[model samples]
Target: MGAGMRAARHYTLALFDALAAAGYDAPERVPRLPIVNPPLWELGHVAWFGEWFVLREASGSHPGEALGNSLLARGDDWFDSNTVPHRARWTLDLPAPGALKTYCREVQDRMLDRLAREQDLDDALYPYRLALAHEDMHGEASLYTLQTLGAAPPAALAPIGQDLLPAAVTPAQSGDGTDAAAGDIAFDGGVFLLGGDQARGFVFDNERRAAPCRVAPFAIAADLVSNADYLEFMRCGGYQNARYWSEAGRAWLMGQERSAPRYWRRDGDGGGWHELRFGRRSALDPAEPVRHVSLHEAEAYCSWAGRRLPLETEWEYAAAAGRPEFRWGRLWEWSASPFLPYEGFGADRYREYSQPWFGTRQVLRGASFATPARLRSPRFRNFFTPGRDDIFSGFRTCAP
Candidate 1:
């Protein structure tokens, strides 16, 4: 848990350092985007979240039992995400960037001081783990925010690679002589446990109510669809064909009026495609997994290829029960399931985290390259609306 917190802190600080390098050292310098929070606000909110759950709330003593004060004046007013409307964030009288960093340091110090005195590791594990996961998520958002602004990649990331850290699936892991996207893997599916329990430490509220789900036999792609695969789709007029798209997809296509994936363009010679990654443009690696594709685009590709997106249940079942040949954990993989609650679902201490977005967003089942290792799990379900293509997302297919 401590190591995870350190990693999150390091990455978050490194991103701020990158911003400082790019003349984005102040709150005013960071653009106000609807998709992301102000950098200063994000830092403060993450710190306040730790303080709220661990320090002020007495390590999640109970759901509605919050009765302590914050170290910072107007911390709740400035940082409570549930209360503070998104647009109002830029208008607030926020502390300077240096002051926000000091607040972050103070919060981390206090949490660590308390952690040092605690003896029962199990009793106090949830709040700390929750804070770590939250920080990791915001850190990932900061990266994409940088991408959106065409800023440099974080100083902590690899200079040449698009990821903070790229984890590749070797031939041994894929059980094939070729790359992960080579072929298909069949699953003779049956009953599968679809969620987490107390046995799995720090299970999210949305992942509770573990129950048996009967899964049908299906064959899923051994790996995610690659850029080369998507290239074929585009080459064959996949974007122009309305029959390949759903009603919502067609609407999105018409709204976007895009002929290629976001951040992609043909070379000047008109010979090949290139993708923009963190302010750098380079030739697309055909073997690399196709990312930044929306769920609508993934569905369109499925139609073009005569396949289908796997259900969230099927995705989870395969990830948990499939052979080593089934590769994942490179990019966020979209599933053909809506984000819905399980039977007997109830909100946890952090009520606003998952309950509000249920049924409105699509389920993304796998972790992306930007995802922290500690937060990566087959049961960890990420969600976003169908129109959001800015995230590090891709898809594989299941035989219909």
Candidate 2:
């Protein structure tokens, strides 16, 4: 098999094996979450997506065509994400875990066979590459879903080689401050190139066609906001005070009845802090960057500190400018900008990926601990609804 096919198969099997080992095979054991998909359905969807793009669509078959000949007869009906409503997925009669695993294997075998027959591996194989990337994304999603469900960390997801284990919090070095090094790194900021350059292989649809934009002189935080920093906001009643929050933010807070960051629990006297990760609870580490906060919570914290979230352009400029002091990739940092299309924006072969969520979502720059290393790039854009706090997300601030 080719390198891309091998990688796609490896990640797909790893995720499925992990889910099965964790007792996610039974439908009753899988917890229901508004933001998460059923594990069984998700597994089949990953395989279906790969087959759709690589085997069917790449072969010039139109959308929803040739379904009867699919590796799994009902694959399209069960896993076409575009047609399958999120809520309706839980109601579907999904195949058993064992049968789903077989379907995944059959799809992988056929994809590999097709890949070997193809001559062009470069630009001609774009759809195959897209399939691999799609599977890798869902692989990360599966892990986070397990986290959201409060399941134990899967053995397949255990860190390899140099990667640190999730449970092991590294001790802060001497002279290392609990908060991000205090200061604003100032930039003269003229016209800077923004968005992805196609020259850079495998640019996502949202990041296509680099364009130059004039940016005003600005300053951004040297490091992400740490748990210690946000703790002060909570103690000062940041959540209760409406002044710190936007109109939508206030509504979300009241609807959810949230007082502190998600997964956080305070001691009876309000002096101690702890956070739940996976299925285990541990004392909150003050020096660690805060995770699992919504855009609203990040904005409120910035208001309380008299700082503001950085514009998406500024975040891009800082990362691409090669400032080693500006630490990111530890968490997905929220920006002040709303998600929108760049100049001359056009959808790629995968139309559903970026065009639909253009205006309603908030833009986030940088990657998180759970993000695949290959997917982490300075130009990559990740967006989510402002109210989403289930994923690993945090924020930094800019001078007002």
Candidate 3:
């Protein structure tokens, strides 16, 4: 428990440093989202979440009158999700940015200081532990915010060599003699357990109730498809082909004239294709997992590859496959299914988590390099509609 808290504290500090280095300390520099928290507002909200759930809840201590009910009362609105209207957060007049920072410091200091004495690691520390994870999610968003504005990603990430990280996927070793051929993870679909079995460990509110369900035997990719993989589809006039895409996906592609990736400039190069990332031009990483593609784009790529997107259940089965710490950090994976409430789903302490996103968005699994491990799990579901590509999301095809 102490170790977890320590990690959380370091992460919290990293978040602040990233923001400051990205120029968000000015508050005015934090971009205002039409329906999302400003980077500064988000920072404070994450801190407030820790206080409300851990520090104050444990000691029965009040965080002063001014900071009184924020963690409890306005917790959801401030830190709840992307669905909320952004213009309204500024209206909340949230503790004048500086006060938010103080609130953050106060909460962190108290939580870390008290973690040593906390005995109810299972119950008492659960909420704050969860809160710590929550903040990590927002930190990733803060990184994306920097990228979208053509500003710069955090300086911590600035030094990463322009050359791609070595490819983690080895298709030649994947029961096939070819690295370019697709791969699969055949799930012996049956009475598969859905959601987190809370008794095992800490899980988010939405993952509380686990249940048994059946799924057909299916095959999923052994690893996420790489940049080289997706480009093959584009090279074959895949985007121009209507049959490979869903109606909505085809329309979206048509609008963008996006036969290629959002950052690519095609083969204008010295013997290889070039792409843009962190606002700089560099050779595309053929071996690295493809990123920044939309669910629609993912779906289209899968179709062109003679495969289908896995159902959410299929994605989860593969993600949870081998129980290998439940992660593939190279890129986010898109599922064939849409986000929805579980069979017996209902609200909990933080009511807005997944209940609100049902019916409107597609499900994404696994985490990208930007995703914090603490905030991810086989049961932690992420959603975005197929049309959006402003964040990190990519996918692999399942066998026919």
Candidate 4:
């Protein structure tokens, strides 16, 4: 937990450094995008979160138990995400970046000191694990925020981004440079254990009630949809053709006047494609998985290709049942499933985490290239609104 927390902090700090490079010198100067938090607020909140759950709250207390003041003066008013409105983050009198860094270091040191003395395992460490996972999640969001702002990724994260660049292989090459598991992999699909349980340490609230779910025998793509494949749809007038899109998708398409994926641009005279990644423009690697596409876009592509998005159950069953052959963790693959709670779902101490967003979002399985390794899990259900293409997300297809 300590290592993970420390790593997450460093990663987040580096992302802030990237923002500094982009010339966002002050908190209010950072654009107030709905998809992101003010950098200063986010950093302070992460520290306050660990301190709130790990050090301030009494041991053996219920999540709702109100107790203790924060080390930071009026920290709750400033850093409690549940209470603080998103827009207000920019207007608030947040401490300077240097001070936030000091707070983070102090809180981390205290949290680590506390963790070192704990002897219990699994459930006992939930609060600490939650804090780590929370920070890891924000870390990924910070990277995408950089992409959103057209800022370069921090040098420390270059290796992670480089891993996604396509090798010198044909566009028809299989996902991740392997020919195996190219097309759809058929699953017999019987009763499969869906969701996480206490046995899996630090299971999220939405991932509870590990029940046996009966999934239909479905054939799902072994690889995520590649850029080359998606390009075919676009070149064939996929976006212009309403027949390939749903009513909602057509509305979104019409609103954006989108001719290609968010970052894509037509290459000069040759008429090939290139995309902007972290402010650097490069040729579109056809072999790389198409990312930053929304659920609506994925759905439209499926319609054009006579395919469908896999249900979350089908995705999980295949991921668990199919071993080395099923490749993921490159992008957060969108699932057809809505972001709903499992049976017997109960909110954890941090009630705002999952309960509020249920039924209003779509579920995305798997992690992205920007995702922290510690947070990557097939069972980790990521949710976003259907029209949100700002996130590092993609899709795989299922045979109709």
TM values, all candidates: 0.92, 0.89, 0.80, 0.92
Best by lDDT: 4
Worst 10 residues of 2 by lDDT: 169-178
The TM-score obtained by model 3 is: 0.80
lDDT, candidate 1, residue 304?
93
Off by over 4 Å in 1: 58-65, 160-182
lDDT of 4 by residue, 294-327 (tens): 8889999999999999999888877766346578
Please give, for residues 1-400, the per-residue lDDT of candidate 1 as tens digits.
6666767877887887776777676667778777877777887888888899888764332334565777789888898887789989877888887888888888888888877777766556777877888899999888888887778976557663444332332111121122333387776667767788557468888998888888877788988999999999999999999999999999999999988889898899998989998878977999998988999999999999999999998888777753566677878999999999988888877877889999899999878888877777778899999988888889999888
CA error at residue 260 for candidate 3, angstroms: 2.2
Best by TM-score: 4
Of 2 and 4, the candidate ranking higher by TM-score: 4
CA lDDT of every candidate: 0.81, 0.77, 0.65, 0.81
Candidate order by lDDT, decreasing, is 4, 1, 2, 3
Clashes of 4: 0
* Alpha carbon deviation, residue 243, candidate 3 (Å): 3.1
Over 285-339, each residue of candidate 2 has an lDDT whose tens digit, in order, gives 8988888899999999998999999999888877766665667777788999999
Minimum summed lDDT over a 10-residue window in model 3 is located at: 170-179
Quality of model 1 by C-alpha lDDT: 0.81
